[model samples]
Target chain A: MTEEIIIAGFGGQGVLSMGKILAYSGIMQDQEVAWMPSYGPEMRGGTANVTVILSDMRISSPILQEFDTAIILNQQSMDKFEKMLKPGGVLIYDPNGITRPPQRTDISIYQVEAVEEATRLKNAKTFNMIVLGAFLKVKPIVKLENVTKGLEKSLPQRHHHLIPMNKDALTRGMELVKQIR
Target chain B: MADYKLMKGNEAIAEAAIRCGCDAYFGYPITPQSEVLETLMARKPWDETGMIVLQAESEVAAINMVYGGAGCGKKVMTSSSSPGISLKQEGISYIAGAELPCLIVNVVRGGPGLGTIQPAQSDYFQSVKGGGHGDYRLIVLAPASVQEMYDFVNLGFELAFKYRNPALILSDGVIGQMMEKVQLGSYKPRLTNEEIVARYGSWATTGKTHDRPRNIITSLDLDPYRQEQFNLKLQKKYREIEEKEVRFEKIACDDAEYLLVAYGSASRICQKAVDLAREKGIKVGLLRPITLFPYPTKAIREMLGQVKGILAVEMSAGQMVEDVRLAVDGKVKVEHFGRMGGVIATPNEVVAALEEKIIKG
Candidate 1:
């Protein structure tokens, strides 16, 4: 099976890293993966996005227009990427600053209170991990053990101490995510 | 030992250069390819391998630095994007004329004069057809994936020294910025001055030695007949490369009615398009040229006999298609489909073009 996903949000939202970590997990599971970021000057502080294609077979063309899943973070991402989600696909978003939620009957819609959960944990840095946790609950494309290994591999050795906190955020996110339609 | 690591394409190029026993790297920062220099700067290879890493003020200065280093019989390289590469052409011509061995990497972006910073193959003509003023050709290696980006650095240097010419790794913004798993090789020690002198003593400008006559490295030949002879020598060397160094990948060409010819990032898209076309019961295949200069002309010619038509896909208006046309020699119908100014043609769109241009045509 293949999961063609787009994770989009503001630059500092860890959108690219989230895709990287997910891609790393795919590698840990011995799956083929491609992670392509939208780079250039506009990617500095403005809207940022990354396309992660995880597949059992070889991946072709990391540049994608439509996606199997659209994991949106901000209102801008939700509005922009909602149209690109395939019919009967998954649309997961953080309902924090979303003024207009996704209104599509064709695809499954789910909301994860990642921002609120990160605030409760008093760790805004774990916001992306929380959202990632929610994504795993919905899709489970990669096993959690692989994700654990991926996190350990991706983070610096000095930052290993923070793994437990990130894990805690991940668990909280899985619990807080609710299916909409 | 091969160690697997996940890295971006540009970073892979830098790491591979260090491991390939590179003597020096001179480059100016450009979008999509800046990481090549950034990684070299961060590693400070001078401390380890004695590789000199200098951020030259402009692409011109950087290429000249490569010329100087190559003239000394050292493995030197410079990298830039499309526009920056345009600035290095004069220096490139000098390096070629001097018959200096060096590596020049162009992580191409969309172009026709300061075009978008997006990936494009519009520089195909400039890279393979001699961007600089001369009757010279660069050994152009087109890498499609991040792993190739790692492998081709060492390969480019090896080919450069083998021919004593400036070789080019013609990549684009997509491969430069994309991240993937790459198995990096062990580090090789840079050749010592004695070893270089022993191998290149006949032509290298390694300063006067008491045992041998002073070596002179100059492209300037005032005598017209001698200059023509020099040009002919370069032509013979290029002909030899074309005969022995053609590299390409053939995907599902057996019993196919149409062929899609692409290189680099465009080839990746064409691969997916081939899969889509096969699913639609259209016998379409992909022919990806790894060496744009050598061009795999013979393979393309043979495939042209089997296929009814060819679709030359690119990220340019229509650059590589000219080469395909030249290879096919009008034996079969050939058409071009591409998106310029940084816009990439998706796999489905490539399939659509294949159906419209080749399959249905």
Candidate 2:
């Protein structure tokens, strides 16, 4: 099975990083993956998005018309990508940022108070980790263990200490998903 | 001969260049090609292998630096995208005129102006027909995947040094940005500066000793006949390159009736199209040009004996198709299908075009 996802938000919101983590996790899981960013002039102030495709076989194209899942970090991301969800696709949004729910009836929507939860955890930047946790809960493409390994491999040498804190945030986010469900 | 590791195309190129014992790298950063610079920076070639890595102020400066390094008989290289490559044409022409050995890489992006930073094969004519003025040729290698990106880097440098001419790795954004499994080749250490000095010291611009005369490296000749003779020598070198270095891939062309010709990223897409066409019981084949220059005219000319029609597929409006038509020379019905300005043609679209334009037509 192939899972195509688009993670989008403003630049520096870690949207691209989130997609990269997912793609790297897929790689660690011994799956074929592709991570493509929306490059060129559109990346200035407009919504920046990255497409990540994880498959059991070789990925032919990086571009996707309909994604199986979308992680929207901000309201603009939700407004931009909500319509492109395939039927029964999952929409994970940061509830603290998005006030309106998706209008689609066929897809499942999970709104997490990502920023608020991260703020409570005393690490506002970990909101991306929270969204990633929600993504794992919905799709479960790779094990949380694989994601931890991916993080260890992807993080820089100096920032390796943050792995535990990020893992804590991920576990908390997963627990929150369970509580909401 | 070894196991493969997953790498981006740009990283693969950088690694391959290092392993090939490239003496120096001078480049400016540009999108779709920036990872090349980043990879070289992280490797710290000077600390590890004593290779020179310089980030130039502009593409022009970078290529001129390549000219200087190459003139010293070192295995030097530079890289950039379409716009940056356009700026480097002047220096490239000088390198060609001076008969220097250097590798130039153009990781292509869409454009006429500062166009979108998306994969494009639009630089077909610019690369193959000599981007700069005068009668000169660049041995252009088009890479389709990350693996080819690595393989071609070594091959491009080898061809440049062997032919005493500039060679180019003509890749596009798709190959540059994509990640795939690539086998790193065995390291072949390049010649040292002193070794090069001892070998080509007669013509190289090294300081003169008491017994030796000063060397002058210039393309200028005051006498018209001397300049004509130099041009003839360059032409002979190009002819030798064309005869020896034409590389291409033919997929199921043995008995195929319709031939689809493409290169770079577009060729990979056409591979899928050929597969789909065969599944539909259509006899279609793919001709992928790995080396854009030398034009692979020999292969295209040979294919003319069997193929009924040819479809030239590309990301540009119709640049490479012109070359294909020239090679075919009315032997087979030749047509063109393309998408420009950062748009990629899908496999389905290519199949549809082949069905309507060549197969059923």
For every prediction, compared with the true complex, DockQ reads: 0.65, 0.23
- Model 2, B1-361: lDDT tens per residue? 2344657789998998889999899999999899999999999988867788999998889998998988878889999999999999999989988988899999999999789789898998899999998888999999988888999988898788778789999999888987665668887877865677775545565556677777666767789999999999988888888888889989889889899999988887887788778998889898999888888988999988788899999999999999899999888888899999889898878889998888778
Per-residue alpha-carbon lDDT of candidate 1 for residues B209-286, written as tens digits (9 for 90 to 100): 787877777889999999999999999999999999999999889988999999999999888888888998989889
Local accuracy by lDDT, each model: 0.91, 0.84
| Candidate 2 CAPRI grade | incorrect
lDDT of 2 by residue, A1-181 (tens): 8898999887766777777777777777788777777776657877788888888986655655668998887788788899989898888887666777578888888877778898887877898898888788777998988888778766878998999888887777776763222
Highest TM-score model number: 1
For model 1, the stretches where C-alpha displacement exceeds 4 angstroms are B1-3, B199-201
Q: List the residue pairs that clash in candidate 1.
A: none
Please provide, for model 1 over A58-172, each residue's C-alpha lDDT reduced to its tens digit, 9 standing for 90 to 100.
7888887789999999988888899999899999998889999899999999999888888888888999999999999999999988888888878989999988888887888
| Error at B170, model 2, angstroms | 1.6
Q: What is the TM-score of each candidate against the true structure?
A: 0.98, 0.86
Error of 1 at B138 (Å): 0.3
